[model samples]
Target chain A: MAIDPPYLLFLGDAADELAAKTARGVAHWRPDRCLGQVRLPGCKADLGLPDKTIDQGAAEGARSVVVGVANRGGVISEAWTDALERALDAGMDVAAGLHARLNDVPRLAEAAARNGRRLHDVRHPTRQFSVADGKTRPGKRLLTVGTDCSVGKMYTSLALDAELKRREVDADFRATGQTGILICGEGVSVDAVVADFISGAAEWLTPANEPDHWDVVEGQGSLFHVSFAGVSLGLLHGSQPDALVLCHEPTREHMRGLPTYGLPTLADTIARNEELARLTNPAVATVGVAVNTAAMDAGAARRYLRETEDALGLPAVDPVRDGVARLVDVLP
Target chain B: MAIDPPYLLFLGDAADELAAKTARGVAHWRPDRCLGQVRLPGCKADLGLPDKTIDQGAAEGARSVVVGVANRGGVISEAWTDALERALDAGMDVAAGLHARLNDVPRLAEAAARNGRRLHDVRHPTRQFSVADGKTRPGKRLLTVGTDCSVGKMYTSLALDAELKRREVDADFRATGQTGILICGEGVSVDAVVADFISGAAEWLTPANEPDHWDVVEGQGSLFHVSFAGVSLGLLHGSQPDALVLCHEPTREHMRGLPTYGLPTLADTIARNEELARLTNPAVATVGVAVNTAAMDAGAARRYLRETEDALGLPAVDPVRDGVARLVDVLP
Candidate 1:
C-alpha cells in the first residue's frame, strides 16, 4: 500500500524547548525561503501505530525530514538511531536539531559519517549565501577590524552595514575566516585559495584609477595571535583600499601592552579614517570607531571616542548610531 | 709559526649597551656557575671584508663565539654574518647580542642555520636561558612567562632564579625555543619531544612529594594561544607544584577578557601557594603585577593593586618593590 510523507517527531516531555530551539534555528537561516513547509510531528500515539511512526515516514518517501531528539546529555538511544537510519535509508536527507548533549553519541556520529550525512553543531544564528556565478569577486574597498573574540565584532559589523544602507550607499561586510564567514554572512574567506582568488579579483574590482568603494572586513583575534595576518596583509597590499579602519576597544590593557594600540591617535573617528590615507598610501577618508557598549558606560565610551576623534581630526561615529554607511561617507 | 686558540669576537659601537645586554643574558642562565667564563670578545670594527673575517675566525680554534652588531633597526647586519661564519667554521658554537635592528640579517641567520649556531636578537632583555646539561632530564620543571615577543618572561624567570639561589637553593635556569636553550646554548629542542619529557619528569618531581624544594616553570603568550598551554598543562599534571605564581599586568582588557584572571583567589599569596595550579586549575598563589611605573605614579599603581587584591582576594604584589623573593616566600 502507498504511504504518506514523514512528519517531524519531537520526543520527551520537554518537547516545547526542543521545538522552540528548532524554530529559532529555522528563523535564523530563513530556511522557509529555500525549503518548503516544515512539518512538526507530534506524538506517535496521536497518529496510528504510535511506535511505527518513524518506519511509516520512511516508507512514505519524504524528501527532507527534520527530527528532534531530546537527549539531555546528547546521547542518541539505540531506538532513535534505528529510526534515524531507517529514514535515511528510505532516501530522506534528515536534519536533526539534537540537543548538544548528543555529542556523546558515538554511534550516531559514526552513522552520520557512514551515510554521507552531517551532524552539525548548531550555534549562534547565521546566514549563508552562495555566489551567483560561482565566482568570488572582490568588493570595492576592504576595511578590517577585530578585537579579542566576543568583543562584539559581529554586532558592530551588522550595525555598520545597517548604517551604510540607511545612507543610500552600498556597503558589504565579510568575515575573514570559515567560522567568521559562517557568523557574519557577508565576507570572503581569507583561506589560501579564496584569498588568492579575491586578491586577483581585487585588482580589477578596486582599480587604481577608479574611486574605490568601502568594504568593511572584520578580523578575528589579536594581530599577533590566531591572526590570518599574512593572508589579510596580502589582500590589503593587493586591494590597496582608499581607507583602512582598525577598530579597537579602548581598554587600559590593550593600550599598555599591545603594540597595535600604540598607533598614533586619531583626532576624531573621521580623521582617524583619513590618517589611514597617508599611512597606507591611500586617501584615508575617515576612521570609524565601534565601541563596546557592554564594556564601558555610554558616557565614558563617548568621551573616549570624542577625544580620540579630536586628536586624529576624524569624525567619530558609533556603529550602532551612524551605521557603516555614514562611517564610509566620513571616509575620504 | 704557533697559532693562538680561537676566541669569539664581539663588535659594536656602543660596547656598554652590548655588554649590559650580554651580561643580562649570562645572568639569565647563571652561566658563570654552570658553563663557566663565557668569553666576551671586546672590540668594535667595521669588518669591511665580511668573508675574510669569517675565514680568520675559522683559522682560530674557538669552541663558541659571540658577536655584537649595532642596532640599525632592531636587526642584525651582513657584516655580523661574516664574523659568525668564521667562528662556526673554526668549530665554535656562536652567539650574538645583535641589537634588534640586525634581526633581519639574512646572511647572519643563514650562517647560524648552516653552522647550527644561534643568532641572538637581544631586544627583550628577559627570556634568556642557558642549559647546564644538553639533555633536559625528566622531572625538571620549566616555567616561561612573556606576552608578545619580548614581555620579560626571561627577565622575571632569571630574577626568580636568582632569588631562589639567595635562599640557598641550587637552581638551573635556561632559555628554550627561539630565545633560549632550543635555539642557542645547550639543550634538546623544546619541541614535542621536550614537552613530553617535561611532562614525564614533572610526574616524579611534584611539590607534594618534595615540599622543601620548589620547581617553578612558566610560559610565554596566552595559555590558549600557543603550544604553551598543552606543554604547561602536561608539566603541571605530571609535576604538580605546591603553588602556581602568575605574573600578570592588570590592565582592564586582560582582567576582563582572560579566563585565567577569573581563577578562584587563594587566601593571600602564601596560602595560595599550597595548591597546585595551572592556568585553568591552579590556585593563584601570587600575582606579579608588571606595571609601567614610569607611566603611572607609584600611589596610583598601589591603589590599583589594592583594588585587584581586594576583588580577587589573591595578594597582588608589584614585581618592582615586593621583588620575586617576597612573592615566592608568600607562596604556600
Candidate 2:
C-alpha cells in the first residue's frame, strides 16, 4: 500500500526489443515523478529519460523501482531479476505489470520484505465487478477509442486527465488494461473478465453521479480487430460516453493479427465508433482525434496531424507530445 | 450421468408467455424421444408433443422431467419445483437449464437421490478451455449468426445439423448457450467464459484438423446488440467459420435494446457477418439465410420466405417450419 512515487525504471536489456509500453505510459502521465531510467548496454530508444545506474537512481531519491517493459509472455529474465534485487537491496519498493508475479519469485519477495518495501502487481484485478445493465449514468463521460490496438488509448486518457486537472476541471482517468493499471494504480483487466461481465467491468469503472466531473476512460482493443473485438465492444457499451476521442497510429498498415483486414481511415473510425456509442446513448458525439506519431518524424507527424485536423474538422494532437489540451477544451 | 430421456416437459403457466425454449429445442432435434407435454390448463403452443399428466407421463415411459420454459431471471419457481418433486417421486430424472442448480436445492437433490434418479444442470460449463491461438483449422466451420438476440440461433444450428445427418454428411453441432447445452448434452457456455478466453472456448469446442467433418457452431448475441456484442464477436472469432448462416426474424422492429437502431436489411446483415468471419479466414462465405417466421400466419410466412429468397438470391428457409435441407445443400 505504501507505493509512493519518485520511480526508477528498469528497462534493462529488454528495452531494445519490446516497446517498453509500461515505462512510456508512466513517463507520459507523470514525467516529473520519474527519477531516471536504468538500462543495460544496447538499450536503443532514449524514451526521453536520463540514463542512471541503479545506485545513482536510488541515491537521487527514487523510492521505487518499476519493471517498465512489457515483454512477450510477461516473463522476467534472470538479468532483470538481478536488477530488481539490486533496487530492492537499495531500500526501494518494487512494482511490475507482468503476468508472472514478482511476489511469486521468492528472491524478489524476500528482498522486498527484508527492506520493508511492498511489491505491486498491477495486472491482477483488485476487486470484483457486476454485470452492466445498460442503464444511463450521470456524469459526463469521455472515452478514448482507437482504430487499432496499442495505439494511444491509455496515454491519451491520462494526458487528458492531466490537462483537465491543470485547467482546474474535475476529471479522472479510468484504466482498463494491464499497462493502464500500472500507471493509474487501479483497474479491471477487462480482457481477463468473463464475456458476460465485460460490460459490467466497464460500468463499474465509471460510475454515475460524479457531480461536475468527467471520467476519461481508457479504451481497449478495436471493434474491428478480430482477436479482441468483444473486449472493445464491451468497453464501448460500458463507458457510454457523451463524447469520444478517436486514437489512430499513423503507421500501422493493417488490423493487428488480421493481415487480411486493412485499418479504417480516420473518418471511417470516427463514424464506426460513434455508431457504436450511439447504441447506448443516441446523442454521443466525436470530439477530437489522438494521433500516435511515435513512428513518424517531426515534419511528417505535424503534417499528418494538420491534414487529419483539416479533413476531419476536429482538433487532433499527439497526446504525449503535444498534450491533449486542445482535445480537452473541445469536451462539452 | 444416466440421463436417458422420454422427457416430461414442465411448461406450467410460463408456456403462455415465454416459449418452451428447452422443450422446443429437444423436440426439434429429437422429437421421437420426447414422451409428452404436461401443461397447467390453457397452455397453448402445442410444440407438437402429446399432453400428459405427471402420472400418465411416467406410466407411458417418461424417464426424465425437463424444466422447459426459460423463465425470467432463470429462477426456478415453487410451483415448478413441486412438479419436479412429483416427477422424481415417480422415479423420473429431473433436468433443468436454470442458472439455479438443482443440486443446490436440497429438497430437489434429496428427492432425486431417494428415487435413484440424476439431476442435470445443463447450463454449467462441462469443460475447461485454453486460450485461442488463432491457428487455422482444417475442417470447414459454419456458424449460425443472428440479427438480434433470441432469433432462433439454436434452432437454425440444430436444423442444419439434422439436415446434414439426413444427407449422411459428416457434421457436428457445437452449442454456445444454455438451451443449446441442453440439446447437445455438453458445451462450455461461451458467454460465461472470461473475455480473454472466449476464443479459446471456441477453439476447444471445435478443434482443427478434422479431415472431413463440418462444425456447426451455435452463435449467441448479435454483433449489433449493445448488451451482448462482445459474446457475439468472441464466438465469431473462435469458430472461424468458412461459411455463416444469417438468422433473422421477419418482424423485429428494432435491434434488441437500441430502439433507435433499426434492423439491417438481409443484404446488409450478410455483408456485415461475412466481413467479421473474414477477419480470421479470408475465404469465409455466407451460404444461406435462416428466417424465423414464428409470429406470421401460414400464408404470410410462406410469402415472406419466397420474397427473402428472391431478394437475397440465397437459399432461405424457416429452419423449424421448412427444415434446412436446401440450406445444407448450398454449403461448400
Say which candidate scores most in lDDT: 2
lDDT of 1 by residue, B1-332 (tens): 01122333344443445533543354334333222222224533332222224444445444445443344564554444565555555555555443342335666556667766654433322332221111122232435433322344555665666687788865544443233331124322222222113333333322332334545554433222121232333333343333444555444232222333332222332232222233113433344433323345788888977886777655556656656665556544
lDDT of each: 0.41, 0.81
Fnat across every predicted model, in order: 0.00, 0.60
What is the lDDT for B266 in model 2? 80
lDDT per residue (tens digit) for residues A66-147 in model 2: 8888666788777788888888999888888787889888899999889887888766555667766678878989998889
Give lDDT: candidate 1, residue B320. Answer: 60
Q: Write the per-residue lDDT of candidate 2 for residues B1-332, one digit (tens) a residue.
A: 32477777778766453468677777767777688888866565567678898989999999888878766788877767777888889989887778788888888998988888888886665556665656788998899998888898888998888888888888888978777766665666888787877877888888875667989899898876766878888888878999899999989998776676677678876776776677678899888899899999989999998998898888888977988888888888
Model 1's chain B TM-score? 0.53
Best by TM-score: 2
Candidate 2, residue B163: Cα displacement in angstroms equals 0.5
- State the interface C-alpha RMSD of candidate 2: 2.3
Local error of candidate 2 at residue B299 (angstroms): 2.7
| CAPRI band for model 2 | acceptable
Per-candidate DockQ versus the true complex? Answer: 0.02, 0.38
Q: For model 2, report DockQ.
A: 0.38
